[model samples]
Every structure is written in C-alpha cells, then in structure tokens.
Target: MSDTPRATRPGKTPKHGTGGRGAAPERDHLRADCANCFALCCAALPFAASADFPVTKPAGTACGNLREDFRCGIHTRLRADGWRGCTVFDCFGAGQQVSQVTFGGVDWRAAPESRQRMFDVFPVMRTLHELLWYLTEALAQPAARSVHPAVRRTLARTEELTRADAATLEAADPGALRAATGELLLQVSELVRAAQVPGRRKNHRGADLMGAKLAGTDLRGANLRGAYLIAADLQRADLRFADLIGADLRDADLRGADLTGALFLTQAQVNAAKGDKTTRIPAGLTRPAHW
Candidate 1:
C-alpha cells in the first residue's frame, strides 16, 4: 500500500444523536471477516503493476488470482509472488457489511446489475468503518474522559451511517465527518500525551523524516502525525505514547521499537513497515508474519 497521508485540518464538530437500537458492536465487528464477505476488496479496488502488485487490475473487476469461491488463488504465496500490497490492505469489515448487511448476502456475480453500485459503496463503507475504528479507540483512553461523551455520540452517528441503504451510502460524503472526528481525536491525543509525557514532548507533526536515522531516540509522547517515515531507521526507538495517526511507516525499520500506547496506529501501517519480534506493539494488533 502507498504511504499516502490521510490527515486533514481540524474542522467544526458535527452534531450527534442517539445511536440506533442495541449497543454498538464489539471491536471484532470492525475487523475484516473474510469468511463472511464476498471478496469485495479483490474485485472493487483497482491496482497498478508495481512493487506491491505483480499485475495491473481495474476497479470492479475480479482479480486474476481470485478463485470461483472468492478466495485468493495464491493466498499463501501472495508476497512471494509480488502481491505484497494485498497482505497489508485492510477493509475494516466493510466488505462483509456491504456484502451481507447492506446487500443482504447478494454477490455481484449473482446480480450483475448491482455490480457498479456495490463497488462504489465499498470505499465509502470502508471510510466509515475506519472512522469507527479510531472512534472506538478514542473512547478507550481514560485520559480523554473529558471527550468520551462526544466520542460515543460520534461513534453512534457513524455506525448509524453504516446501516444506511446502498443508494444513500453511495452518495454519502464522509469528508466533513472525517474532519470532525479528526478534531476530536486531536483533543484526545493532547490529553493522553500531556498525561504520559511529564515535560516537553517532541512535535514533529507532518515532518518529512523519510530515511532519517532515528535509532534509539527518545520520542515519548511525540506528535508524529502524518509524518513521512518511509525507509527511516527507527530501530529501538522510544515511541511510547506517540501520536502516529496517518504516519507513513512503509519500509521503516522498526526492530526493537517500543510502540506501546501508540495512538491511532493501524494494522496496515504496521504490516507495511519492517519489524521483528522485539518490536513492542500495542495490544489488539497482530505482529506481521514477515517480521
């Protein structure tokens, strides 16, 4: 996956309402459940031939390696065959949501008329699910208690959007919603970082630190949000409590790096980076197999 920055400037907070019936689903619901999905990621997303992919594939077209049963033909050998991007790409459960929940288990093959619409809605749902993941994490931070109420409300609102019908989802504009959530997350980051780092903390938000040698550095509570750290040497770096949201860590050396309590770090980001068993990651994320 490319290390494109996803951060946006803070915007006005949006209004929230009481969420839909029943409590919000657990974190597991926000993760990609391929068993319950129709392989939307394989068909809906387009890719160009590069270091990450061996061949070019267009959007709304099933990958050449996709099997009739919706599984990758070479799942076990994706990376070895030069499909490294597929291993790190994540849909955050949006595939199953669009396939089973929104479309009621209807596969695009069964109803070709809905193919284009389904492909379009997939990305929108993915964005909403990604926001939900961050919002859920924000609510778990005790130091951000002051904003927990807002976080809960926003989570509910975003969840409600996920349940909307196909047409509604296709036309949904999550740009404003993303900005609002970004602002709230910034507040939470400040609260947690202030409490974790006693004195002056490094502020490197949006810095271009690509290929920089930062081994064994003290970066506790640092705001490295949206920084480009591609191919940088971060071995044994002290990144505890660092705000890593939107940081591009592709090919960055993470051996022995302490990412415990790192804020907004996603599995895709970790999977894209180089790490080892000694790298300490936050709870709930699996260590990359290549590490």
Candidate 2:
C-alpha cells in the first residue's frame, strides 16, 4: 500500500470567539488539514508552466514532484523551484473535508473509480469553504451587528450543503450559492462601511483599478469589492475597515500599508501580493514569506 502524506499546517493561529455570532462556528473546518488529505490538489488540478509552476500539467494527472506518500517533494522549496502558484493556493480546509468527510476517507489511488468524483467535489468544497470564511468574518464585525442574525442563518444553510454526497456535490451549483451569500455579505459590508465617519469612505465597488498608483492613499472605509488591483502600488496606504470581498490583489505592493481592520481579505489574496513588516494585516492572516 502507498503511504499517505501528512498535511503541513500554517504557523499561525486561528481567531477565536463565536465569530461574534450567537453560535460558535467550526473555525477548525476552515483551516487545511493536509495530514488527512489525499493530495488531491497535486493530482486533481491542472497547472501550466509560467511565473508560477515549473511545468505544465493536465487535469487528473499527478505532478512530477509529488512524492509516493502524496506529499510535495518540493513543498518547502516551491517558490525557489518556480512553483509560486502552488504556494499561493489555499483550499481553506477543503482538501481534508472532501478527502475525509465527503469521500469517507477513501483515497483515489485505493479506489480508482472514485478519482473523477473526488476531483469534481474538490472545487465545489473549496467554494463552499470560501463562503463559510466570508460568513464567519461578517458575523464577527461589530458594526455589522444588524445583519448578524441573517448572516448566521446563511452560514448554517451553507454549512449544510458542504456535507452533501458525491452525486449531490457533482450536481451542486456553487455559482448560485455564492451569489446568494455575496448579496448578504454586501449588505453587511455596507452597514459596516457606512458607520465610519462621513466623507472618509471611498466607493470603488467593482471598479477596474488595475495597476493604479494608490501608494499612501487614504482609503479608510472604502468599498473596493471586486476591484482589480493587480500590481498596484499601495505602499503606506490606509485601508482600515475597507471591504475587499473580491478584490484582486495579485502582485500588489502592501509594504507599510495598514489593513488591521480590513474586511473579507483572504490569505490567498495576501499571498499573491507583496508586503513587509510594516504591512499590518488582519489578525487571522499570516505574513507572506516572500515579503
């Protein structure tokens, strides 16, 4: 029998509290449990040789660097070996959830028939987990207190869907689910951003601000949802209480920027950008090593 690879967890600690809601959500479910995973990411997904991966790979094919035990042989040296894309990918605990819970601990190698189904469920689980992350963040915002009850209800609904079987998962439409949750999150973000001092909030929601020079910009309580900020110069920018739900921060410079209270800022976005010691992120997100 082939050995299973153990998951490598991040060095950071998760945030505590009921995510600020009446019920304490399962925070552990959001973090990747690589040890229990079947290396689905390295096998099920496709990648191309670019500034990220070192080679091109087709879907359902395993990476050359994947060890026999389902571990990445170059895990610690992914960036050094021209695999930056692999380093930025965060399943948000979807890997383990699908491997262990959805598939009932049956690995693709052990049960070849389940391989295709495993690949199908992985992305769906990722989307559901992402929604959970945003919902948890919305519930924790004190300024969004008016929307907490609704957020909790949505969170429960979303969690229920994540536990579906393989066939149900394959038939699931994550786009519709994401759209529904996004509507509520937007409402919560609006309430929180509006509570800030008048005239200080900037509204660039869904704007294409790609590569704009926003260094040292005063963006307190700005609504930058879905903004394409790829490679923007944001050094020393003030982004406290900004709603960054779907902002593309790929290669953005965040050196010396203060994002202490930024909302819906995921670790994947931060990992794709540049930052330094002075780039203050939210408590849950860890600093990227490349910065």
Candidate 3:
C-alpha cells in the first residue's frame, strides 16, 4: 500500500489470475533473486524500531544484520527476533534487476562511489516494477477487455523504463506514471466489480477502519480497495468476492474469515495479517508457513 512492492520469501511466488488470456509471462524478474542481488533492500532502505524491525537503521546504510554475502545473518530468525517487517517486505524483483542489469553486476561494496546511485535507482526501479505488476494484472482481466490495448501499451512503456540506464531511472518520475496507470486500473476494477452482487455494499476505499469491529459482517462482493484494516476485528467475517486491492491488512484478525474468491489479495497482505488454519482463501494462494 506504500507503493513500494511487498517482499516474499523465495519459494512463495505470487499466484496471478487463473487461466487469464494473454496473462503476463512468469514474473521471475519481479521476484527477489537474492542470490543475484547485492542486498539492495537491506542496504539502500531504512528501517525504524518497531514490531517489524529490531533497531533503527538510516537510509543508504547497511543493516547490522546484513552479512558479507548480502544475506541476513538472522534470516531464519527474523520473526522471532522482532523483525517482522523483513518477513513482509517484497521488492517485486527490483533488487536483482538493479544489481545485475542497471549496474552491470558491480556491487555496492566493491564500488563505494556507486553506492548512492545504486540506492537512489533502487526505489525508482521498484516503483516501475510495481507498476508492471499492476499493468500485468490489468491485462489479465478479461472483463476489462476494453482497456487491454491501453494497458498493454502502458505495460510496454513501464517495461522499457525498467530497462533504462541508472541516470534515466534516477531521474524518472514514477508517481506520475503510477497515477496514469491507476486510472486504467480504476476502470478495470469498475468493470470487474460491476458483475458481482453485494449482499451489502461496503465502499471503504482508503477509509480508516483500524480496530473497527466487523465480525460476522456480510461483505460479499464488497469493494474494500485501499481500506485500512489494521488491527481490525474481522473474525469470521464473510468476505467472499471482496475486492481488496492495496488494502492494508496488517494485524487484522482473519481467524475463520471466508476470503474465497477475494480479488487482488496479495501474499504480502496475507503475510502481514493475522489468520488461523480455519480461514478459507481462494485457490492458488497458499497460506503462509508461519501462520
């Protein structure tokens, strides 16, 4: 929801639309190829003392737990060690792209002068990749066929920007691009949401629903796009056919919630939220191992 793509573990790749025509190719580049990356997320980004991070780290500074090999020293113990943020952070594959492609495989450690450039370009690359993720999703929406041509062109433009040089990437304004693509996605969402019948309409786009009690609510086919559901009591809520694109679900209780057919529910959101084994999700997305 921060516009920064969320991170997922190696084995937990995002499962896109089922049998979507002209579905984008496998997003291997959008994934965190840590082996090929120089730990851009751990080094270029900053973190604060919170439930997700153990200590405060300044931007462009390497995290204390970062290893010489560009892996976290306590990677396996991140959650237990009060670094829950690391577990939920996904770069959408910008780390490896900037490391291997933009910088020609030169690492920040070896070239100190390039470190700042690498850090600056990393976020730009990430934003572009995030746009790619959305555009690909738009193309997969058969219901939004009217906008597929524009979506395809936009996707191609974003892909070209991702392949730009470091200078171009650093100078690129991705917010404007995201704004333009967001308009198209909005149209797509309208087309998709129009088909579903809501038991009770819940138009809480970007609304603050944190800590709100909504247990056993009939939210079938509700549009909860960009809703802030942090720490909300959603126990046993009927969220079937709900559109949850960009919803902040951190710490939202999902025990026994039925999310079957919920649209645009990312793995990152699921990983950040609270749930139990009884919670039902759509097919293709496996429940987090930690949950």
Could you tell me every candidate's TM-score relative to the true structure?
Answer: 0.91, 0.91, 0.88
Model 1 weakest lDDT span, ten residues long: 3-12
Which pairs in model 2 have colliding backbones?
7-34, 7-35
Q: Write the per-residue lDDT of candidate 3 for residues 1-291, one digit (tens) a residue.
A: 112322323322223222345665455566556666788888899989988787999999988877776767877777888888887877777887888788887788889999999999998898888777667666666777888888888877888888789999988887898788778878877776666652447788888999999988888778888999999999999998788888999999999999987776766788888999999987646686677
* Candidate 1 lDDT (Cα, 0 to 1): 0.85
lDDT of 1 by residue, 111-142 (tens): 89989999999999999989988988887788
Error of 2 at 74 (Å): 0.6
For every candidate, C-alpha RMSD to the true structure in Å: 7.2, 4.2, 4.7
lDDT ranking, high to low? 1, 2, 3
Error of 3 at 253 (Å): 1.1
Clashes of each: 0, 2, 6
> What CA RMSD would candidate 3 show?
4.7
- Give Cα-based local distance difference scores for all models: 0.85, 0.82, 0.78
Of 1 and 3, the candidate ahead on TM-score is 1
Candidate 2 has what TM-score?
Answer: 0.91
